[model samples]
Target: MPATPAQPSFALPVPVATTVAPPDLTDSTLLDVDPDAQMSLGAVALDSRSDVVYATVELPDGARRELRLDALRPTGDERLPLVVFLPGGAFLRCNKAMALEARRHVAESGFVVASVEYRVTPDGATFHDSVRDVRAALAYLRSYADDFGIDAGAVALWGESAGGHVAALTGVTDGLPEFSDAAVLQGQVRAVIDAYGSSELSAIADDFDEAARLHYRHRATQFSAYLGRPGAPFPEIPDAVRAADPAAYATASVPPFLFLHGSEDMLVSPSQTQHVHQALRAAGADSTRYVLKGANHGDVGFLGHPGTGLPWTSAAAMGVITGFLHRRLDATER
Candidate 1:
């Protein structure tokens, strides 16, 4: 196996002492890496964009399942930082194309990005099953690092909504054997970025407004559906639900977290992230929260509006994420 190149550390782009700031993120010191830098896995171009790879794992029932990961290989040297992204769909389904597009910015910024297609509830799966798959995905990526040119140790997780919940849960419970399948290594997630993820499954249903309840009256609520309990009230939260709550596992040893939630989010509620952030802080762990004003659940606005030239641009978010990864995963100091 090729030795993993030492990840470089740079000061976080945030200005600590500034009388006046640069006009845009372009002027920040963090913009050192040209986002358009060329880096690709050492294979003939699979397609126009990504290559799909399957990672197989054995379930507790002795059944085998294949988890799919769509890889966005980089264009630079071998052994780049790896980022595993899980998509949002209330844990019921995932839109592969949408998820890949959402994380495209990360991959384009000189990292090997893998969009995970973990088991979901509609397949008779539960949080436990999804978590095992998440672990398997990480282990599979690391085990095949040489083949894919990824740095095994410098890995991060990013997810949105339901995917965000799993990402946060996995981050907090990194080394716990319970979360890992026998065939998979315990997850060593070094950093986490959760966008509008639900941590406390029991309370998420209540976050729905009267209009939302009316709209989903015929369908099972997200919490109830995921828990496999129709008509279950918040007061009757099951032990399984509590066990799945990422906040329950928060500790100082967990990796640094960057949470982004829309202030106006009705579904899942911004408080879900706020609670997790509070728990992380209370545990003395590194945490950062960015609340988007006037943004709602799954809003593209959170990714930044290019036409408006806003301060909270996608360029800015990438800087924050890349900077955080450098600080947490890199060995050298700025």
Candidate 2:
């Protein structure tokens, strides 16, 4: 007889009791629900076959946003690990197109993948809104873990560019009272993937100035807007800029991090990733940095496009991600 493969073990998620039903996406009224409504907390709409759910997440101040989560467990496994992906668009908006990457990750890694929508700075928002939104989504996922068959204890945060900064902030600042939400989360992030995210705002300020002198700069870049003053440089807004810089907040308690960047990334310099990685290691946190040679910002090469024929591939990047998560999250499961 052929040998049977060993089954993966997962910690059973705590069941949630609620009378709140899945909201109708078309109803604008459901757009903003009360977070205090226990029955409606983390309310979401779902597709049974795909195991994908769209959660109507309520912010601390009662504003609302929708979060998409795709549950992709291997056949016969009752539950699987979770990986939350934050999309990059500077801080202006969360790109909707990243859903394709989410699906690809599910197919390749068999992990529950979540793509979050955070309020961008262009909507009169700031770094606070983005960070709070990501935290709220994290709480919602854990609060309703049973409904999604997610291993609440095994979770990772992955992001690119601005999204990467948000993920880094959320993970590095875990357990701070101000950052917590209504959902009583029981676990911590096991790993983080930061792909070419700006680690320091001061560096961005310099980048903006150089772009301006070259006559190729937009009147208001995302970083300036995120500082609450569009077209202003970081030197003029030192305090808020410092508050939003992930490198400034790096601590020993941060979860293991994998930093990826293209050596030639002109938008968010590869140096930003390198600096943060150094900070993490200095704080005694586990970290790794990989630079894709001659890759530009947001290019296909960063995602490991084989057609680009770059020396580095997205396959290589994804491989490092899964390997890190497996080592971190799977080890915890065992």
Per-structure clash totals for the candidates: 7, 3
The lDDT per prediction is: 0.65, 0.60
Candidate whose TM-score is highest: 1
TM-score attained by model 1? 0.74
lDDT: which candidate is best?
1
Off by over 4 Å in 1: 1-51, 57-65, 205-220, 228-231, 300-313, 331-334
lDDT of 2 by residue, 139-222 (tens): 777877887677888889988878888888777877665555545463468889887788676654233334332331333345
For candidate 2, the lDDT comes to 0.60
Candidate 2, residue 212: the lDDT equals 33
Question: What CA root-mean-square deviation does each model show from the true structure?
Answer: 10.9, 16.0
Off by more than 4 A, model 2: 1-76, 182-187, 205-220, 300-313, 332-334
TM-score of each: 0.74, 0.72
lDDT of 1 by residue, 1-334 (tens): 1112222133221111111112111111222222232222233322123445566656546787666777876565567788888877667675444544335556665567888888775566777768777787788789888877788888889888889998998899877777776666664788999987988765553445554433333344545646656556545656756888898898998988998765555556667787788899889898888765544555333223322112223444556766776776654521
